[model samples]
Target: MTAEIRLFPCLTDNFGYLIHDPATKATASIDAPEAGPIIQALEREGWTLTDILITHHHGDHVGGVAELKQKYKCRVVAPHDKAAKIANVDLRAAQGDVIKVGGLLARVLETPGHTLDHVSYVFDSEKALFAADTLFSIGCGRVFEGTYPMMWDSLLKLRVLPDDFKLYCGHEYTASNIKFALTVEPDNAALKARAEEVTRLRSENKPTIPTLLGDEKKANVFLRADEPSVAASVRMKGQSAADVFGELRERKNKS
Candidate 1:
């Protein structure tokens, strides 16, 4: 059976995701921004939390881990390479590790741009990725701990996934990301179309996540850094794709 996903708002712009495998009856929470909403969501679904998957050590991502663990006794799975920095970790996972949530399996992909130890979980059976902050609808996370090359290399990992994969990122930053992406690729019709859609979604107080990576490939500037058009738009023409990616990230940082 395919996993059932529930997306809910948490801690202002941050988001919380719960994935439940019906066959196994195992439920996992991807990054807990706060305990109240996660607990409430679990109660609402009548599902018990079996696992808490963490992407990084950021407070907003893990602030509720302690509380949730205290209440549910759930196992906390975090990045093995950076486990020392994160507290209350029960399992340390890295790239190539496969974690089973009941009958569903998630393959961990180390995506260290937002943070050196950030990891994204991909469930091939569900064609879903809990990307946390590494990737977003129209942009990516800031390069806080990893270098531009590292971030670019990490993003390349997602290229192997099918285009139909749905990306579930950490925040509700699509509207703002679209504004910055427009500055990078103003002439991109797909980006323009996506921006209009995002604007309408925000106008209606709706979530704009769960976007297909195929659409992101066509519209997200960060994902298209290898394109000559994107490189020229950032004045990094004739440069390596990594360099273009760095320049685009710098522009977003300044934006």
Candidate 2:
């Protein structure tokens, strides 16, 4: 059976997701940005929270974990790094670890760049990727704890996923991300089209989560660092893809 998913707003710009396994009636929250919205979403969906999958140690990402765990007694799966200090973790997962929410299985991918403890969850069978904070629709997370090269390597890991996988990132940064992306790839037709789409979506107050990986690969310049065109846009032509990626990130940081 296919899993049921819900997307709702959390905090100012963060998103909260609930993935439900219909066969087993197990529901896992991708992250607990806030308890109120998650609880409200669960109540509306009529699904009990069975698991909480944390992607990183950022306060906005984990602020409600403790409350949700205490209320539902749900299992919390977080990154294995002890330095993160997230509370109420039942399992600490690293890369290659497979976590099961009833019949649905998710493979853990260590994608540290924004923070050293960051990770992403990929449900291969369902073609769903929960890449909180690591990747956005048209951009990537800022490298906070890890080096630029490390961040680029982590992005490459996610770039290899099948194009059909649906990416559910952590924020509603698509509009701004697109603006910054256009500066780097001004002549990119795919990006221009995506920018218009994003503009329309935001104008109507619609969420742009769950973008297909294929579409992102076409428009997201962060994922196109290796392309000769992208390299030339920043006057880094013939340089390594990693270096081009770093330049793009630096430009975004300042944008």
Candidate 3:
């Protein structure tokens, strides 16, 4: 059976997700940005909180963990990296680990870049990827604790996923990300179309998430850093893809 997913806004731009398995009635919060919205969503959906799958140690991501755990007595799963120091973790997962939330299974992928202990969860059967912080709709998280090359490597991990996989990211930065993306590939037809779509979505106050990996591969310049066209756009024709990606990231930082 397919899992039921709920998306809601939390703490300004952060997006909170609830993945529920109908067969087992097991529900897991992807990350707890805050307890209020998650609690409200649980109440609205009539689903008991069974687990919390944390992606990183960021405050906005883990801020609600304590309260939610106290309320529901649910399992809290976090990265195995002791350095992350996330509180109330019941299970610590590493790369290639498979976490079972009732009948649904999520494979763990170590995708550090925005932070040293960052990870992303992939529900292969569901074609869903919860890539908090590391990957966004049209952009990626900043290389705060890792090297640019390391960040590029992390992006590559997610990039290799099936094209049909649906990406559920951490924040609502698509509008801004698209604006910056246009500077790198103004002539890209797919990007231009996506820009228009993003404009319409934001105008309607709708979420631009659950984007297909295929669409991102075609329009997101960050994901296309290895492409010859992307290299030419940044005037780094012969440079390695990692260097080109670094240049693109630097430009995004200043944008």
Candidate 2 lDDT, tens digit per residue, 1-255?
A: 799989999999999999999999999999899999999999998999999999999999999999999999999999999998899999999999999999999999999889999999999999999999999999899999998888899889999999999999999999999999988888889899989888888999999888999999999999999999999889998999989999999999999
Off by over 4 Å in 2: none
Query: Tens digits of per-residue lDDT for model 3 on 30-90?
Result: 9999999999999999999999999999999999999999999999999999887899999
Predicted model with the maximum lDDT: 3
Tens digit per residue, CA lDDT, model 1, 33-90:
9999999999999999999999999999999999999998999999987643788899
Give stretches of model 1 more than 4 Å off. none
TM-score of 3: 0.99
Q: Is candidate 1 or candidate 2 better by lDDT?
A: 2
The per-residue C-alpha lDDT of model 2 at residue 5 equals 88
What TM-score does model 2 achieve against the real structure?
0.99
> Could you tell me every candidate's TM-score relative to the true structure?
0.98, 0.99, 0.99
Q: How high is the CA lDDT of each candidate model?
A: 0.91, 0.94, 0.95
Query: Would you list the clashing residue pairs of candidate 2?
Result: none
lDDT of 1 at 32: 89
